[model samples]
Target: MTKDQLLEMVRDSTQVMTLRQKLALVAMLSMPAMIAQLSSVVMQIIDASMLGHLGTHEAAAVGLVSTTCWLFGGVISGLATGFYVQVAHKIGANDAKRARSIVRQGISCGLAFSACITLVGLLIAPHLPVWLGAEEAIRGNATLYFSIVALAMPLLMMNSLAAGSLRCSGNVKTPSALGVMMCVLDVLFNFLFIFVLDMGVLGAALGTWAAYFITMVLMMYFLVAHDRNLRFSLDKVQKFKPHWDTLSNVLKIGTPISLERGVMSGAQVAISGIIAPMGSVAIAANTFGVNVESLCYMPGYGVAEAATTLVGQSMGAKRQELMRSFAWISVMLGMAIMALMGVVMWVFAPEMMAIVTSDADVIRLGTEVLRIEAWAEPGFAAAIVTYSVFVGAGRTMGSSVLNLASIWGVRLTLALLLAPTMGLHGVWIAMAIELTFRGIAFLLRLKFRLKIRE
Candidate 1:
């Protein structure tokens, strides 16, 4: 067999693309996504570095409520997924008008949902730090940070909808470019709000809020006015409100994914509660450790975004071979990049931690956890990209269930058992083991699904 056929990760792709062409196609789609995701990680790393200079207490304060913030953020993303998946499918089917129609409906529904989130966040902000068991000294920062997040919810929701719509329409460059712009805005704002104003953690939060709000407006403008697939004609009647059928289709695809993210994010909140009592050093370490790992996992997330869009479009076009080929290619590429990153993380763990913080104890502990976690990075990448493939193919529920079970059943249970004895090490070990299991399971599932086609 020729080398191209031998490297074929999926049998169906035999007639779809040669090895060189597939690699080029994956790069065309994945590069923009990679850039966007990397920008996000850089934003986080910068935030962490800025906060770290304020000492362990300031860093710990943000860490205490980070998971809670993620919980809400995860749900919001889920909501966006509902509408955008349909857009992807429509675009794949070469129905640009329908895709544009979905964008309009998405904006309306997303804005309404965001309004509700804002109200909910306002009600919950004052009390959330206490609920998460944060120390009294740190609670004020947590409260202020969440309040800003609440106020920015509308803008964030708009950005998510607009960006996802663009991605689905095969225009990753605008969103990627916008993401870099947002990161730059965030850094500048944080410098003024945090360093110049000396606002500490609250300043960090405000900067983040301003960045998203501005980026949202810019991105939304692009989607509404400039996008090829999403720019609707002005004369269309009932332009904003989508039909019930269209709305349902979005919900049908997005609900399972939302539910999955909701539960997983909630679990993260619970895990954070467990971590809160471990002292400021531990909390800082946990936070910094997460950031450090971002260097390794960011590529996986980037590749996953590409897989989702490519697979979603392929499915919409009813090109099963193309979808399978894209899926395997993305997954393999993600695994390879992440594996290399993981090795770098292992060797430079201390340096990575040092970049984020100067506290010797915090850096030392964070480095250890990162090294322990690095072993699982490739598997983690596998699960990340594969799930996106599943989502694109309208098979999100099963992957969601597997992820949920792995996090809650395997990770949390082990963490609870190990934390008392092993402290932060225990918690991270549980995470590592769960990620490895999750990755293997996802790959097996992908193999089985392809086997059915054979």
Candidate 2:
């Protein structure tokens, strides 16, 4: 079947469903992705809990450096997004050859980008904690953790490229399943390495690295062996050279995303700087709270993925009305789901926090911050899904600008101003406020833009 025929098949299969049915379909489609995200977070929680047993210093070491690693990783992921989204659009437009070409470019870009990041990350890993203002007790472990993650950067980038290509072809299920498996494997490996083998922080890092390598292999096998729209062809490889046109197109879509993520990473560092002087307890609590809260936020991310696929395809087919309809529907659904999650989180904060730590102080502090942030979950959902909508429409630069302004202009400024005075509570309050603003701004953008029909 042609690519357009395939998209029509998907749409027809989905369109007949009732609103509830469509939501259900979306939810079902997202379940594997959700599980993938949940498992990943669960592994982190497990890793943190295990390290917490080694004393707060080890846990803090991992916590302090994790965000920096994530920052570097996000840039690579963003680069893949460009080519992947274009693949979705091309497939929708009934151009499989073009889609494959984009995929090849994504592979090339992902490897080159990963190598550059790995080199920089390795060079700076030793001094990262000192630069972040980490306490002397936690600095060495933090540096080691950063170095291990940096070494695995190329594998992680390749995994992102494969997963993104799969998702773009409307194959979310495979990637999601593999992601969940990756998380489970990480936890299992961490158990053996950290406890059974007594490798400490190194064990945790190695486990995560192994998980990525395995997942990358699995995803590659599926794309090459099973996917009809994407298969590795020796003939294509012989013909492949860097296409400036495709590279420029991908970067046009991706650069802003990278900047947005990069800026957010910077803001995280800035926020960390503000919280650094407040003492270890506050920093640790903040770290725990962020990870715990990811559970609530991740579902929104799943919905956003669906939105990106649906809206991008709609745009490609020149179904502008459908694109707008999908965008609004996705935003509402995401917010509703997140709002419910927030309520549950607020009600059960202590119980949830207790699972990750035995210390009364950490649990108490974490519970408070989680509950506080829970109030802003709906707004957070709006920002998350609307950004997806913009990306689907090929309007990423504006989204990136909004994200940077929101984080630096609103979130960080408020965080810095409040963290010293209010402690962790102050930092979360700033986050809640910024999320609300981001949602409002995105909603307005959606309203004001001229609806373009392809």
Candidate 3:
């Protein structure tokens, strides 16, 4: 058979699967990743819930520092996306050696970048809470939490690199499985350190650090032990040298993705700063609401990952039609899942907030925000899944530009105008409006782009 015939067979095989089959495949592929993602979010909830017992001041401290850590973490993860997507494309093209080389380069880059983040985060640790306008009562604990996370930067970055590399090669299960394990371990460790030992916020940070270390080790094991195309060998080290061309390619795709995340992180910090002066009640309430919202939103992210992989592989195979199909299907799946979640959140908002805190005021504020954001889930789902499609197609520049514009131009602008007048409600309103705009823009782009035909 000719090469075209072989390619046709592969495409036909994948396409022939039923819609239920497709959803199942996507779920099976994304479960571990989803579980892992869920675990991280669970840890956050657990951390806050545990700290909530300590007092609102302690819970507020964790909330204040959490966004900054996300910002730092986001930048590293963004950098990893650069290499991981390339690996996905390469593997789809049947270039195993090239894919392995890219993984090595990613490791080298992750280490270097992690070191820089560690240095910068440590330097800013003491002042981060102050910068965010934290009250005197929570500032010390906030600084401690921030410093511990900063110290774990290397481990977190390594874990991200390993997970991203494995997932790109079409082995999402390993990373996802490890992620669940990490989450479980995180909660267990946090329970021991925080409750039993009474270590406070520092204990929570330590639990996270330990969890990341465990996940990174497991990820490294899977990459070496099971990944056929990704096994590292000393002999290959002799052949390895910095390939500027490959590095440049990875960075070109990755930098924009990272900047998109980094800018969003910065925007979170800015938004936090804006909300800070509103008092600790507003700060704690917003933080809890955001975490609760993640329960609905994260599944959309899981579907988005599947979209990235499927679309990236399709593009690599030069099956442009498949790419378009994958994009639409993924977005629909994301929207459907999240819309369902939104309904659940709206109906059970009080119960969800209760899981995080017993504070009457915090729960009251959080439930209100959750109910409002629930209506915006479909838009959020569309934006996330479509952005994954663009990233998979190596359209990072467009995705980045759109993300920055949506957040800074639309979201922030609306928040500035409305926050003073509406308080926390204004922030949620701005988010819903911006998400709607973002979703529409992405859908329009997908419609206009020339479809890839077999």
Residue 153 local lDDT, model 1: 75
lDDT of 2 by residue, 210-237 (tens): 9889999999888766777777662255
Residue-wise lDDT of candidate 3 within 1-454, one digit each (tens)?
3322333332443544345555555666556666667777787787778888778888889888887888898888888888888887886777778888887888887888889999999999998998988889999999999999988888887787788778767778778888778878988999988889989888888887888888888888888667866777523453445589778977788899878888998888888888888887888889888988888888888888887887777777677666677688888988998999999999999988898888999999989988989998998999998988888777788878988999999999989999999998898889888998998888888789635434
Clashing pairs in 1: none
* Candidate 3: segments with Cα more than 4 A from true spot: 1-24, 233-240, 450-454
Output the TM-score of candidate 2.
Answer: 0.94
lDDT of model number 3: 0.81
Model with the higher TM-score, candidate 1 or 3: 1
Q: TM-score per candidate, in order?
A: 0.94, 0.94, 0.94
Alpha-carbon deviation at 370 in model 3, angstroms? 0.8
lDDT for each candidate structure:
0.84, 0.81, 0.81
Off by over 4 Å in 1: 1-16, 234-238, 450-454
